[model samples]
Target: MLKHSQIWRAIDRLAESKGLSPSGLARRAGLDSTTFNKSKRTTREGKPRWPSTESIAKILQATNTSLAEFTALVEGDGIGRPAPQTLPLIGFAQAGQAGYFDDAGWPVGAGWDEIRTPEVTDPHAYALEVSGDSMQPVYRDGDILVVAPDEAPRRGDRVVVRTMEGEVMVKELLRLSEKRVELKSLNPVHDDRSLAREQVEWIARVLWVSQ
Candidate 1:
């Protein structure tokens, strides 16, 4: 028996797996932004409104999800199950400020949002929303980047570096040594920067990016 609640929950889970809000998923599917909104899920009298089969099909196609996979979710069978872990999400602008992270670079304190993403190797993985045009061409405003604090960044890996002076930046690791680290900007208009090792508070590798 297919329950309405189960189907709706499966849709919500699908959106989460893609690192999107329900409206984001709808927009990706070429549907109205409010198509899957909570308010649209019920009538003015509070009656449950079911999702159309066409809408479900469109979302599945847009997300590249198979019907079998979506069915498993609706049936609670766990096929192609999403990551069980939830990561803390903060804007890149706010990440530079103090009190958001502890000494180890793990997220701390309030004002942090949450997102469900695929399983990350690092338990200290977190997400940052790109803001402004600093990292443009590679990362734009509203893009979400998943970073792993526990993973050591090697040469050529994209990384997020925080300085003791409360400056945070995303750059590609060009070189590293006991004395200083060289960072390359993703945008050609920006110049490369070098920071002394002692000045860096933490350096975390960017594991994934959701545009």
Candidate 2:
């Protein structure tokens, strides 16, 4: 669950990362200087008042930060920069081909290249070179998607799913039930998908995108 304190702390950390104060962040976002003031974080009765989604969006755009990165901050997932880590890399087009991944979706076999991603700690992590416009407006063509096959996919998390029919796709996980998994398309024009549990060969959480 997301907490109001986490959102505010993420804002503070974001401001600090950019060498700005809360007021400066707000101002840079074209919002009032007092928009993020500590005094306004609560009501007169002392209840927590969360920041507006619009405000968060504005600050993210102002800081040139990705939502995944910001979510990481909110979740406190990053623990400073660790040594660079290398992972097996393959193109999105090749993901559907056999021999690249095991039955459990872990990367395997030859024809795989290597990519260095900072702070990626998953030993089973792999990179997929995104192609085409099917996942645009979020993941662009040529963007590198870091996938953690070991991480469990949660609702609203970006994920990679491979069907038993040899199709690989990236979509937002919508719902997971005993019988089926629902996915929401990243591109508005693309239709959503619903796959039976048996039809889904594997599902992995997308940790982040390196654009």
Candidate 3:
């Protein structure tokens, strides 16, 4: 059972962790500054007004944090403070970085919008922000992508992968055999790539991308 007050506590903790005020956090999440304000938590008649799920999702997206991390904020876990970790946070054009983010679904930041996601029991599953239109026609700039590191991708599954030689790319997993994997780009203007299985360091199945 979810409690109403837990939402408030979560918001407070997230703001504090990000070194921002409630209003500042709201604004950063591209939400109304008053969305998390204490006054907004009540109605004119003094009835309790809980934060909307939409607003909460936006807040999470803006801060680059995952829902699981936000849960810790409410549980009073030690994660309320921000710690630097290499997680997949790429602009569409810059996603081609090397082994920069975790492939096993580690806890990314919080205060992010909830994009379309499949219900998974794993708490560390999360989405990353796309920066440019390079992955357009499939993924646009500012889009959020849901990634599941635990799932082994088969043929035709879109995935976020890092090459052992140091490069990250989000592409369709075209085919895979014992020794190699082939990938296709969403943009027709872009070409495809193939590599030996041993040359790949990690892969995460991309579940969704929200505009």
Kindly provide the TM-score of model 3 when superposed on the true structure, using C-alpha atoms. 0.49
lDDT of 2 by residue, 124-145 (tens): 5799999998898998999999
Backbone clash count for every predicted candidate, in the order shown: 0, 0, 14
* Candidate topping TM-score: 2
- Tell me the TM-score of each prediction against the true structure: 0.60, 0.61, 0.49
RMSD of each: 18.0, 15.2, 16.4
lDDT of 3 by residue, 1-211 (tens): 6655556766866787789877899899888777876546545332457788899899889988899999876665645643213233444334444333443324334333444444532234556787666677998877888775544466778998777766777899887666777889988888898988778766677876667
Which candidate model has the greater TM-score, 1 or 3?
A: 1
Worst 10 residues of 3 by lDDT: 81-90
Error of 1 at 25 (Å): 43
Give the Cα lDDT of each candidate: 0.81, 0.81, 0.66
Consecutive 10-residue window with the lowest summed lDDT within model 1:
38-47
